[model samples]
Target chain A: MFYAWPFATLLGRVLQPSSVVDTLTSPGIGRVIWFTCWQALVSTALTMAIGFAPAYVVARYRFRGRRAALAIITVPFMLPTVVVGAAFLALLPERWHGTAAAVVVAHVFFNVAVVVRLVGAMWAVLPTDLTAVARTLGASPARVLRHVVLPLLRPALYAAASVVFIFTFTSFGAVKLLGGPSHPTIEVEIARRATQLGDIDAAAVLSIAQLIVLAVVVWWSARWQRRSEHTFAAGRTTRRPRTRSERRVVAVVMATTVAAMVAPIAMMVARSFRTSSGWSLTPWRTLGANEVRPGISLGVDPLGSLAVSLRYAALATAISIVFGGLAALTIASARRHGRLLDTGLLLPLGTSAVTIGLGMLITFDTAPFDWRSAWWLPPIGHALVAIPFVVRSLLPTLRSISADQRLAAVTLGASPLRAWWEVEVRRLPGPLLSAAGFAAAISLGEFGATTFLTRSGRDSMPIAIDRLLGRAGAVPHAQAFALATMLFVLTAAVVAIADRQEVVDARRA
Target chain B: MLDVRDVSLSFGGPPVLQRAALQVPTGDVVALLGPSGAGKSSLLRVIAGLLVPDSGSVWLDGSDVTHVPPHQRRIGLMFQNEQLFPHLDVAANIGFGLRMQRTDRATIASTVEELLAVVGLHGFGPRRVTHLSGGEAKRVALARALAPRPAVLLLDEPLTGLDRELHDRLALDLAGILRATATTAVLVTHDHDEAATIADRTVVLGADMT
Candidate 1:
């Protein structure tokens, strides 16, 4: 439903010979495409550069509060883009807001966590002995890094860069807020053409172009990452910093990462409480009031929007849990096409959410199936982007159960289903809860499709935040910041609790 | 020459190696025999500069290298499981040590070819390490350890996992290679036949033995 219907709708329009030439010839479209590629490249480079030291520190050294630091850094990756936009808006001076620099910074804030996680996971497993062996052969530390460590980490680096690139390339909400008027990405351009200009053909052409690029990048990254995906037996036995310089590096990296991740959200929270005289809770207290901004009346009640978002997230969680769990089970048992099915499941994550929204708009607007006004449409849209997370989280945990355990159960007179239930399902609550937490987090902060489907007064949390930030009043801005802080705390708490539970389970196991 | 003095070590339990001392003259192969959990591998790790002893020092050629990092110690260790680099082919694995020393491409190629020949795997250089049989992989690992030509080579149960016939064959090959290189070496093993076949002298390590 996510990729097929969207591509089919896009191809229907793109197949026209005039559409391609028209989209390519439009000077504005050409510029949007160029700027999108340039920013994505630069943002991916910056994210990789900023994330490397921290990832190395986390993976190679054991320090006090290291695990907590990892969990905290991951919060930004799960945050709503509008919240991140609000964070930068609150943190940066007025002169720096709504610029290309702001957009790039926000992109880095959102994506650096990905590089840290992917590269750090790989860096941890790599036996320290390989480098030790190289050193014994007269290689210096720098030489060992170049000849031994870099070659080994190249695949993970490629994968991280690819994911960050795709994310920045398809960015919408942050680009909408932080990019101002002069800088529009392909996704931003697609949203404008589809919603504002009603230029469906141009949107379709751009969607196709973005999908083609995304597919190629994802495929190449997967090819490289597959080489590094071996089951590592030797666990990460981290040690404390052994030298003064080592201690300094760890301190600096950890300090910078914590500040970079935390300060923006902190500023947002602070801004929520700031009034003309001093800090107060007036903005939060007025969440239920419909405030007027100059001549315009903003009718949204922040609490109502929060409730709507919670309901949508709950519905999305249910849908994804059922579908993703069944998909994981099928893939685990499948002897053929499993890889293809896995890739298919992940296609929605790589494709632009704007394209999927437009696809749903056009495809579901006719006869008895007019879901344009349905409350369930947004949750379904959220599910399309969320099921992959569910499957990815559950599939690995499910696959990790050795088949011998099930075989042993069956040999003791249990049926196959009963054996699987006893050996696998009994061990699944931890991962399933983690998957649900991830799905709920994604649903709560989902903005791209919600922006398309939501009505003015019945907006979800992210859409409401985006709308609040768009208006011209201190009240709207404060409400947006307060709401963003709320979303941040909610999502962070979910993800942190999930991670903590997983860690506790790991210790027990 | 290698010397280990009073190298007692433990992991918060009963000592694995207590007041252990050994000396090997230049160009001699000495085997340390012990049962499982008898600290034979732990002792080898200490000598190879991978582990630091609690109250002893290690000397190589009359210089105390106890505090030297493993890489700077110039000691070669082939693990019991034959820890070949899975990402590299047989040829690259054999030449990994030389490459780390920044040896030129031509010399690395020749040295890898020679080592492969020494291990009787000349034609198998291009094969993936993962594709190799267990015995073949062990040979590649041996070649990699020998390629650096370190001062002291430590072999930890290099023949333990092989079949009986292959073990006997590789023991003879290993003996010939040691004699040909005149390499100062320490072999850790529990099998008495393996120790007798590979070493000039044997040292037994156990709670009852001093």
Candidate 2:
């Protein structure tokens, strides 16, 4: 009901007479779309350039703080795009704050970790000896990398690039906040048409257009990722850099990536501390206290928003783990229908949150199925976004498990489901916990959908931060920064735990 | 011809290879035999330019190639696990070295076909390496290593995991292939009988080699 009902209503509404034809003929919709595509392409290219070097260094050579470096770089990926927007707005110069360049930079910052994790995982398992063998066969180091390593890494590269492209293309929160009024993307325009302008028909048409484009990209990327999948036993053990040049390259890449990732976040935190007179923690201290100010009140306290965010994250994580685990298990075993379900689950990832929120509002406003007033509506939205992450994390571990173990349990008199539970799910506590942590991190920072579903006086941290920044004054701006900092710390903690669990799972495998 | 002079290496443990020295004349097949942990594979790696020895040098033909990168060394080392590129087919794996040398397509094709026949994988050019059985993969690995006709080919326990009957049969087949190619090579193995059967000459390194 949560996923299909909204999506069905969305498609039904979009298919109404003259809806698609009218939207397609509308002026500037093409420009919004064209701008979206080119900017996404630019952001994807920049993310690849920035992420590939660090990924290669981390995968190929072991260095001090290698894991820590990877963990640190991924922190930005888990932060709310609202926080990301606020950070860039604060960190960029006045002229650069609300430019297309700022939007592209924030998108790259948010999606670089996707490349690092996906490409690095594949790179790590690749047999290093293949490269050595190429070298010994008279290929130069450059030729070996180009012919041998590049060909082998092609699928993963395409997969990462496509995924990053899809993410940047469907981006909502960052572009809307950072791209400013003049630089409206399809997602931003869709939101404006739906909520601010109260034109649901136009929004439905835009949503349908966006979904069609996303379907093609998502299918292509998934196919490439599937093609790249290998069953090789992980053999390449990382070692210290063999030459001074190698050492230098590793140092430069690591230093640059860490600085780029950390600087904006550091600026955001520093902004929270600075008052009109001097540096102070007054904004943070008054996070809960509702002292009257010149700007917007937000009605809900910041601390209350933090607690609400945690509660939603916890609820979303629980939902994601259960649904994601069941979906992965079915996909791993079932033949045709399971495959369709697998693709269906990932549709939410490509679908813009604005569309989902609008779909929910239109679908569930009636008497019988009115979930619009439910406290769990936002968590459901967060869970919809988070389930994909949980599934992505758990599927590999589930597939790696042999089926004979479950069969053995079945032969010992356990029911089929019970056998699978004992053999597969019970033995995967580490992966389950890791998936849950990832889901929690994703839910904790989710902003795009939350912006629509957040009830007044019941805003999540991201919604509260967005509201505080929406108000025009020094106090509200400072409070937004403070809340963003809190989110940064919370997400960092969750990601740290998740990363350690991933490492443990990799080792165990 | 290849030479290793007084090579020493340790991974913060008791030195795996201490003052290890060996020499083989052109077209000579020499086997280095030792127990498990005697660093026979390490010695082969040091000679193959995969590992740099602590305080010694490796000479290929006549020049010192101690610091040369593995590719520039023009040497081949077949690891114990074969490590065939799973992405390529059998013929492509065999022709990889020739292609790296930038040989013409026809010549590479003919050479690969000849090597496949010699490895007894005739007409298996398009077969994926993952489908090859244990003994077949080993033979393909040998063919691949010999394709470039390196100055020295290093084999580390190539038959270690095979059954005894298959191991002995492959040892004899390998002996015939090595002699036929006239390729100077170093074979590292712990099995006495297999080494004695395959190598023209054998050098046994003691547990406490100085």
Candidate 3:
């Protein structure tokens, strides 16, 4: 809808032969598309390289500090892209400023969690019996990995790759902050045209193109996943003693993962506390101060932005629980003709957030659904993006509920509704709570699409930090550092709480 | 009485059972003994209404129940794993079937208490299933399946995971429980001794049972 009128106008203008030729032969658009693909591919490969060995180690071995390593790998995934970009900026040498390598490195740093969590979790569940059988048949360790492990791991690996590709393909903040003019991704181009040039037509075209690319990638990945079929034996023992080679591999993987995961975060922490005079608490103190600008009477307060962020996060979490819970229940109960509904629920996870924000802008900016002027748009947008995660986390637990319990209840003379309540609904507390916690964390850090929907003076934490970083001053930069630190701590707390709940549930099971 | 006539079942690409027939009179404990791959479990599943036979008819008490779901058919199934709800306590597990039937709280509590006594698990209601020893868990699973008062009970290798002493004792106890309750059951197992001890009649199954 955002592009309808502009496209029509362009079509009208291109009715002339000369204009039509120009439109068909634009070099700038082609360059943007080429650069977008290049950067996304490189970022995905680098992320997998950094994440795969560690994930393999975690899945295959039992060692000290495994839990801590997993936590560190997942922390970046929960962080807002703007915060991660800011951390990278603070950490990278100023000499390598405005380079493609910087953007690729930042993308890798942010996406390591995706590869580890998705691939590593599935790898851990592969049956040990398959490997044992292959070894007993005299297959070498490397051969077993190639023939036995890789075949089974293919589906999960492809799924993780598809996810990482979509995220990098929609690269916005990291590329904008770190990329040179020669390496602008399509997402960065879209943002620039919409915000700086106000070329809504160009931005819409780029967004539509991005959506098409993502759809193709997702389709290909789904096809690959469906064709690969192998089921492992259940109830295989997972706690095997590690051999010497396994021990060395695990140790090396752990060291590399820890270094890659912790370096940028350590850099951010150091920068937050550093001062010209000495290491000081000036940044922390300035978090509450409001510095007035030249010729402007009012100054934006960092604390005020923080409060708005908290309010939005809370609201988004509540909305996600309500809407996402309904969607999950519908999928769980729709015994027949449920495949379409399930696919619809998962569609948001693959679509780019920026494209969704653009659609919302086009659909709701006027007429019967004029939500542009309302304060609810940002939270609603965040909820739409967070629903997919909630569904993914809850669906597995729901599916695993045994059929006997429900039947047992019904045969005992209970009505169907009563049986459902007693058997399934009563057991949903663990997954629901954890999913809500994750949605809350996502809302707190979300920036990509929220940037498009947020009205003037209604900046989120990421937006406020971006504003502070853009201005040239010591106090603003310090305040931005402090805000970033606060955001980090808030997200860390949410993740830690969710992690504890998961551990408790696992122990109980 | 429960009857299965010319039942067939197949998985993804091939048939596992073809035109299998069986009958159980009321209060009869029949054992279906077979080798590992003789389709005993599949036949049991078909009778329990968990799997619909490709083409067959099922009758319970002279009523056609071929289209009924497992819950509506009033059948109880116990797996070799003692598939107790890990989240629920012993008492809760026993009362789960009754609660599903929406029995009144007073009745549920009393029935659970009676079953716990019968299983020699008095005062064990509050303990979590994960804490139970192998023998205790198997008993709890049996109590759970029996609490609902199903017309027919299905036990799939109920004693497979127990040690020899526990298995022998539980088999005897189980037979006594079935006789006391006058419940009809179909026991599926590979152990001839277990079937001999617990069943009133045993049907040996082979690859060509169909």
Name the best candidate (by lDDT): 1
Model 1 residue A205 lDDT score: 88
Number of colliding residue pairs in each model: 1, 1, 5
DockQ values for all predictions? 0.32, 0.49, 0.01
Residue A89: error of model 3 in Å? 1.2
Residues A400-445 of candidate 2 have per-residue lDDT tens digits of: 7777888888889999989977878786788888888888888888
Any runs in candidate 3 off by more than 4 Å, and if so which?
A: A1-27, A125-144, A180-182, A234-246, A292-299, A367-369, A401-420, B1-210
lDDT of 2 by residue, B99-160 (tens): 88889999999999999888888999999888989999999999999998888889888998
Best of the candidates, DockQ: 2
**Where does model 1 sit among the CAPRI classes?**
acceptable
TM-score of every model versus the real structure: 0.86, 0.87, 0.65
- Candidate numbers, best DockQ first, in rank order: 2, 1, 3
Candidate achieving the largest TM-score: 2
Residue A180 error for model 3, in Å? 5.7
User: Per candidate, chain B TM-score?
Assistant: 0.96, 0.96, 0.96
Candidate 3 lDDT by residue in tens digits, A1-509: 22234234333433556543443355687888887888889999988878888777777677788888888888887787877877887789976657888988998988888888887887888765445423322234565576567777888888888888888889777776677566788887777666677665566666666766888999999999877644443443344333456677877888887887788777877787776666878877767666434564224567878888898989989988888887787777684655787877666776567766766665675677787878888888888889888887887777777778789999999999999998888888888889888998888888777877887677888888877777666666666777887888898898788778888888988
**Candidate 1 per-residue C-alpha lDDT over B1-42 given as tens digits, one digit per residue, 9 for 90 to 100:** 999888999755688888888888999999888778888888
